[model samples]
Target: KVMGILPFSAPSCGLITKTDAERLCNALVYGGAYPPRCKKEMNGGSLELQFTDRSFKVYHECFGKCKGLFVPELYTSPNAACIQCMDCRLMYPTHKFVVHGHKAQENRTCHWGFDSANWRAYILLGQDYTEKEEKARLELFLDEIKEKFD
Candidate 1:
């Protein structure tokens, strides 16, 4: 099932471009970052979203929707490989996660962009601030996966 959707996982589909993924990642991060100042009349929780023309529609809209929008409950992707975030699931109880591998595990290693030290940064997110959000809010609920190593 994952192979059907994940671009990096699938060989046949090359529709996922580097820039497109980056844009999508940025949109999602921004949507998650800035919640509208409005609030639920009863609960006072923010119910907001900023949609784009290229957004996937349903899932994207709901990302900024109120808490009770869904009935059966839906689960989002854990390691948004395109954006490189890992632990944002700690925000809400209903938001679930898919654990890939332990940080110290040698098997789950990656080489991010090469840096100036001339040493390969073989760690999670390839040393490109994988888990850290370049735009996502750090002081909010998405703190667990904010640091380079947590």
Candidate 2:
């Protein structure tokens, strides 16, 4: 039998149709990055998929490089506010999340601008919603953020 291994980064392979890719992306993102929890059929795969928790590195806005500084190595606190670059700890308040394919600017400046095109649709877990519902969800998220830090 012909078999191949896929990387965790590219969960949606070129061989997958758009619809199927959407389904897969939804499962990967909303299921807390676990595919098996979202889809039962995925459990039958011989391939072993392992992933780290939400931890990710930060490419310092100051230096602009990876520099082998991983998030897990830098911070002891659970809050993102506590996470900092290894070299410039407690210096820069805002740092890019340093994840591939997504640019999440960690801003504390209170500017509420969001690029609609940049929305990570895969994180929605295949839920179909109207524009009104989408707006409500966005507002709810914003409200929660305000409540958390206010």
Candidate 3:
């Protein structure tokens, strides 16, 4: 599952342009001089975004009844790849799709886009750390191994 779904303000309806995709990616990834890897794919009526490091596959509604609606209120099913988000449940009372990864000792890592209104980041022993933690750890690790370029 991808992070939180941000509402598209433009009148193009639910359609996302290339520029919008890039901007959103940078905002989510947060790189000072270099941004993370993001690939936008137009799959039928949905816009799919794949982020490299985060291992997220985000799907957005580009057409149909959910047009102009980001996230589009999910419905629960018995699918193996679905897990309801605790943070998003207060705002959206529905189950969300989830994907599991083999890395990190085969833990169930979930992604959530951080919206100021839905900012509830938590870190469990088996769960992914909050963005703040990730950023801090990343900076420390990078500093240890980074090459000085003059």
lDDT of every model, 2 decimals: 0.25, 0.29, 0.25
Worst 10 residues of 2 by lDDT: 117-126
User: Worst 10-residue stretch by lDDT in candidate 1?
Assistant: 54-63
Q: So what's the TM-score on candidate 2? A: 0.20
Pairs clashing within candidate 1: 112-126
TM-score to native of every candidate shown? 0.17, 0.20, 0.16
Per residue, candidate 3 scores C-alpha lDDT tens digits across 1-150 of 133223434444566544344334533542211111312332453322212242211222111101111121121222112112222211121111111111122112123352311211211112233588765664453333222120
For model 2, the stretches where C-alpha displacement exceeds 4 angstroms are 1-42, 46-98, 102-130, 145-150
Instruction: State the lDDT at 101 in candidate 2.
Output: 22
Q: Could you report the Cα RMSD, in angstroms, for every candidate shown?
A: 16.2, 17.4, 18.0
Residue pairs clashing, model 3 = 3-112, 3-113, 4-113
Off by over 4 Å in 1: 1-5, 8-16, 23-28, 33-36, 39-150
TM-score of model 3 vs. true structure: 0.16
- For model 3, where is the 10-residue window of minimal lDDT? 61-70
- The lDDT leader among the candidates is 2
Per-residue alpha-carbon lDDT of candidate 1 for residues 1-150, written as tens digits (9 for 90 to 100)? 132112334355556444234333433443222123433352644343322231111111111222111111112333222121222211221221111211222212222432212211111112222355632332232233333222
**Residue 93 in candidate 3, Cα distance off native in Å:** 33
